[model samples]
Target: MKEYIDLFNRLPNLIILEDEPLARYTGFRTGGPSTVLIPTEESSFVEAYRTIINNHIPFFVLGNGSNVLALDEGFDGVVLVTKRALNHISVDETTITSGSGISLSELCRVALNHDLTGLEFAYGIPGTIGGAVYMNAGAYGSEICNVLNKVVYLDENGNYREKNLSELDLSYRHSIFQAQKNWIILSASFSLEKGDHDTILGKMNELLNRRIEKQPLDYPSCGSTFKRPVGSYASKLIDECGLKGFSIGGAAVSEKHAGFVINKNKATTSDILELCHYVQHIVKDATGFDLELEIEFLK
Candidate 1:
């Protein structure tokens, strides 16, 4: 691990920070330190990513870190950051191809700029294209699978490959990526329709306003805390269980939106995990519904 990290540091235009705090990269803002690699160039990023994958080095590919909760003790391996490095987006007629690092907000803006429609559901999301692809991010009765045409990714062997939309196994807040953790997303293309710019802008604004009005955006969170169980919504269930505004240490269920678990104060990783567990327990005892977490807890 040390040898490859040192080698990555020597790669031109690659920014390598040893023993860097995970809090600086993640939205939770409550984790210890690890070695983080921030790619400044595409070639360097690709080389480092391939090396880490092919050599079986312990590593995690992080996007905007809006959906991950790192452990308090932090990771012992490398964290590959792909925010500014793999940021590329292009339009080909009605198809839009974007690198995994591009923020969802920017992607929506680009779609609107091209007078394209179908991605407004993701307008207010703070995650990156990579995270959205991995989780099949959705909102307002729409999901990424509805428009995604294909995915270009690096297989477990660190070889570039492309897969059609049908092969991704996309579902509500789930994707094949969860089962194939070693497979790294590179880019994806979405099929959209030419629409009136004003119409697209209006749709985007509507969803953004909905998020702002209902969510506790002032605090750090991994968006919704739990997946909606069959025949019921997680937020509605928690609200029924009287778990909203419940707190453990600095972590609390959002009073504004029961679906979210926010870092209310200076929360610790333990605080967040414990609070989530408490909510799950209470909700299950009250309603008999199993509440599965939507956020990824990284150790």
Candidate 2:
């Protein structure tokens, strides 16, 4: 990674460090250390990409890490995490432009503040804007694709480009970025319609309350464990398989929400992986439908 060294040397705005524990920075609370941890800024993203490209080093762009499972051994390459910086948002009429590092909860709050009616479904959703766009994250039948107008992202060649919603191919929690690892989301524009401020806030709060009531918020989890299979729901299928509250070490299929694999207490990455394997095996054996994992497992 001489290119990485060269890039790092030129990019001063991004905070680059070494031997950082990823678990301490993620929502799942389990992951090994990383070789290099770089917190990037909008101005430095291009240069950082240049470093990665020039060095020919594999890199990971992470945001909140809410939907990923990092192994105990950790990652050997560079980890470009969007956390502290990238927190800008602007609204004009019904259009909202957001940085990739902004959290979904915060984004919902922004929308509510502006009396926007489109983002209520994202009120309690974890992860950042980049992750949401990559997954087309949705709840209550609303997705990022519903409001997204265009996306400004870094393509494979380290050049930034803007893509319209039509090019994203957004479907059930899947986008062009999900299928193509080379695309790195930088910012997005969402178009919402005006609504009553109080009504929007109330709706957001209502959805948040619903999430709290149904999901296991007491434990550390990456929300849903499996994707909703076509024509069926993963939670209902797992619950029907009689695998709720199942355990493997410190990890357990949430008693409250079967679709959520929770870290009961002192859970290890190994424990989480084991429980996921068990859930998939049992659910497949019972229903003959392979449970596709929604969580990205990384090492």
RMSD list, candidates in order: 1.2, 1.8
Model 2: residues with Cα > 4 Å off, grouped in runs: 1-10
What are the per-residue Cα lDDT tens digits for candidate 1 across 1-299?
46767667657877888889999878788789898988877787888887787677789999999999999999988999888688989999999999999999999999999999999999999999999999999999999999999999988887899999999999999999999998889899999999999999999999999999999999999999899899999999999999889999999999999999999999999999999999999989999999999988665
Q: Candidate 2: worst 10 consecutive residues by lDDT?
A: 1-10
Q: Name the TM-score of candidate 2.
A: 0.95
Model 1 local distance difference test score? 0.91
Give the TM-score of each candidate: 0.97, 0.95
> What would the per-residue lDDT of candidate 2 be over residues 170-238, giving only the tens digit for each residue?
998899997878778888999999999999988888998999999999899999989988878889999
- Evaluated at residue 72, the lDDT of candidate 2 is 84
